[model samples]
Target: MSEEPSARGEVLIVTGMSGAGRTTAANALEDHGWYVVDNLPPQMLRPLLELAGRVGSELPRVAAVVDVRGGDLLAELPATAQQLRDANNLRILFLDASDDALVRRFEQVRRPHPLQSAGTILDGIREERRQLQSIREGSDIVVDTTGLNIHQLASRTAELFEEEGAPRHRTTILSFGFKYGLPADADLVADMRFLPNPFWRDDLRALTGESEAVSNYVLAQEGATEFLDAYVQAVTPIIEGYQRENKSHSTIAIGCTGGKHRSVAMSLALAALLERIPGLRVRVRHRDLGRE
Candidate 1:
C-alpha cells in the first residue's frame, strides 16, 4: 500500500558530523513514514525531487541523507539546495556533537573517521567541520547528539518530524552542566547559576532535579519564577518569527554548575510555561544529569 501524501511534499536534507547519529535519525524518519534516501549525492537531489513530483503522494515526505562522504562534491550541496528551494518545500537538518563525543564514538565503533585518511581522528573531524561550516549555519534544524545515545537520538528525530502535519514549531529544552561544556546545537542559552544551588543542600545533594525534594528546593529559590517568566516572554516573539520563516525546530539550553539540579528544574519549569504558546511543541531533556 502506498503512503498518503502530506499537504505539500517536503524535503529534509540530513547531514552532520560523521559520528553524530545520522543513521539513527534516518531510521527514525523512515519509521515515521518518510521516504529516506541514504548517501545521496548533491547533484542527484533535483532528479530525486523530480521523481517524487512525478509520483505525487507515493513520496510525500522525502529525506535525503547528504554528508561529507560526497567529498569535494559536497561543496556543491549549498548551491544545489538553494536552487531547488524555490521549487520545493525544502529544509536542512544538521546533526552535531562535541569533539570529545565524536572521538569517543569513533573509538567505540573501532573504525577510522571517514575523513581521517592519514592524520589523527581529531584532524579529520576538524577538516570535516571546516568543510561543513557553511551548510550547518544554513540548516533549518540542528540537533546536537553529544549526550544522546542512539535510541535517544532516534526518539528526538521522531519528535521533530513525525506526522500530524508536524508542529508549527518544535522546541527542545535541554539542561546541561556548564562544566561539561555547552550544547553545540543550542539556539538560545540561559544560565541558572544566578539562582541558589540545590547541590549545596546536604539532603538534596543525592537527589536529581526530577525528585520532588530537589525540584522544590530549586524552584523555591528567589528569582526562579521571575527568570522563567521573563525568558518566556523574551523568546515568544523570536519563536513566532521562526514559524513565519518556515523554521521548524529550536533548542534552548539551560545550564547550571551541574545538570542534576537548578538547570533541570528550570528547564522543566520553562517547558511548562512555553507549552502555553499556541502551536508549539515542547520537550525537555537533561543532558548531563547522570554524568556526575
Candidate 2:
C-alpha cells in the first residue's frame, strides 16, 4: 500500500536474528493491514506469490517470516527474492538487535536460541549473524530494535510500509487512569489530573465523558482550553514529520486520577483538534473509562 494501487500486490520477507523481534514486526505489519505469514520456508515463496497474484487486490500486501530454521533451504532466499524483485514488488525486511539485547530477551523468555546447539546464546547469535550477512546486505529495510521497545517497534514497522502521499498517519487519543499501569504503547502522554475530578461532583459522579454535561464541565475548567491548544500545536509538527518518515500510527495517552471523567473529556477535545491537521486521522478511545 506504500505505492500506487495496482493489480499487483507487494511481498515482504521478514527475517533475521531469532530474538530480534521478528514476530513483533510481523504483528505490527498485521496491525497495519498486511497479510502476514510467519515461519515460511524460502521454497514456498513462489507458490505464495503466485497465489497472491491470482487473488490480486484481496491479498495485496503479504509479509512472510523466514529464519535460520530453514536449514539448507535458507540458501535459496537470495536467488528467489532477486528473481521476483521487479515483477512482484518484492522487499526484504531484516529485523535486528544488539547481541546483548537479544540474549537478554531470550533469557527473559527462558528459551534457548534455535542455533544454540550445545552452546551459549551468544554462540547462536554469532552463527546466525554470519549466516545472515548476505541476506541482510540484500534487504531493502534493516531495522535495529536495540533501542526500541515493543510499541516503538510496531510503529516503525507500520511506517516502513505506509504508502506515499496517502493520509496514512493515525492518532489514537486514549484516555486512562494513573492507577492502572501506564500504557506501554503510548507515544505521547498528557496528565489531565490538574482539572477538577468530575467523579467528586455529586451530580456528575455517575456521568461519563460521553454525556454532554460531563464533557462541558471538564472542558470548562480554567486551563483546559489552553492545554488543548498547546498540545495540538506541539504535536502538529511531530505528526507531520512522522508522515514524512512514513510512520503510520501514534498513540497519545491522556490520564486523570480515575480516567472516567477528566481524561476522557480531554481525549475527545484533543481528538477534535488533532483531526484538523491535514494528514492525520484521529480517533478517541477511552482505555479505562469504566475501570473504577
Candidate 3:
C-alpha cells in the first residue's frame, strides 16, 4: 500500500496454483534472508504469524507458502490474511504462470495434478485459476513466472527486499564522468562541458567534481539549469518504474572522455536532484576521475 517500512514483522505469504512455481518462490525468499515455512495449513496461519512476530526480533523477515493442499482450510485464507495484517504488516506475493506453461512444466516434471481426480490436468488448472483469482488480486506483488528461470526470480526477489538494510530507505548509485559533466542517475544527467572549463580555470584545474569550487562553478551555468529541468522529467519515470518493479538498487552512470570535467559536474547535479525523492538512499561515484 504505502510502501513504507513497517515496524511489525514483514511477512510474505506466497500462494498460487499447484504448478505455478510457488515452491520456487518460497525457496528464493528464503535465500534472500526470509525465514520460510512451506505448505503450512491455513488454520495455522494465525498462530504461526503470532509466533513469528514474538520471535521476529531474531527473524524479522518471514515467508509462508499456502496452496490448495490445505483442503477445506484453504477457503479460510482471505480471513487469515486479514487477521495477520491486523496483527502485523503482512504482504502477499502471488506467483502465477499461464495455464499452458503450467501444463508444460508439470509434464516435464512428470508430477500428477492434485486435482486430477475431477478431470484432466487442464481442467484442474482452470479450476485452480478460478479458485486463486481473489488471492491473486489481493497480492502486493504478482510475479508472472511463465518465462522466468529460477535464478532470475531469485535475483528479482532480492531486489525487492534490498531496502531492508538501508538507513534512508532509498538506495541510489550515481556514476559520473569528468568530461560531459555528471549524469543525474536519479532525475537526469546534465552535460556541463558547455560551461567554462574548470580544468582550464588555472586555480581550479586540479580539483575534482567533488570539490566545492568546481561544484559551485558548474551549478552556475545556463545549460545546467535546462539540463536539470529536462533530466527531472526523464528520470522520474525510470525511478518510479524501478520502484514499482521492486528494484532494490540502481546505478546511473554518466561518462565524459576522462571522467574529470563534465562527468564530475553532472554527477554532483544528479545527486542534488535525487534528494527530492524521500527515503531514497543516494551515493555518487566518479568512475575514471582518479585513473591516470
| CA lDDT of each prediction against the hidden true structure | 0.88, 0.86, 0.71
**Estimated TM-score per prediction?**
0.55, 0.61, 0.54
Candidate 1 C-alpha error for residue 32, in Å: 0.5
Best by lDDT: 1
Output the better candidate (1/3) by lDDT: 1
Global fold similarity of model 3 (TM-score): 0.54
Residue-level lDDT of model 1, residues 142-224, one tens digit each, is 99999998767876887788777566678999999999999999999999999989777889888888888887888888998
The C-alpha local distance difference test score for the whole of candidate 3 amounts to 0.71
CA displacement after TM-score superposition, residue 185 of candidate 1 (Å): 39
1-292: candidate 2 lDDT, tens digit per residue: 2332232788889998898889888887776778999889998987888888778889988999999999988988999888778677888999899999999999999999999899999999999999999999999989999998876787687767856654657889999999996899999998998888888899999999888999999999899999989988899889988776657789999998878889888898888888888867888899988774
Q: Put down candidate 3 lDDT per residue, 1-292, tens digits, no spaces.
A: 4232334577778898787777767765664567899888877766776676567578787888989888777778888787667557788888888888989988999977887675788888888777888888887888888888765676566666644554222444454454444444544343445666677789787888778887788778667777767776787677766555445466766655667766677777877787677546667776677765
Rank by TM-score, descending? 2, 1, 3
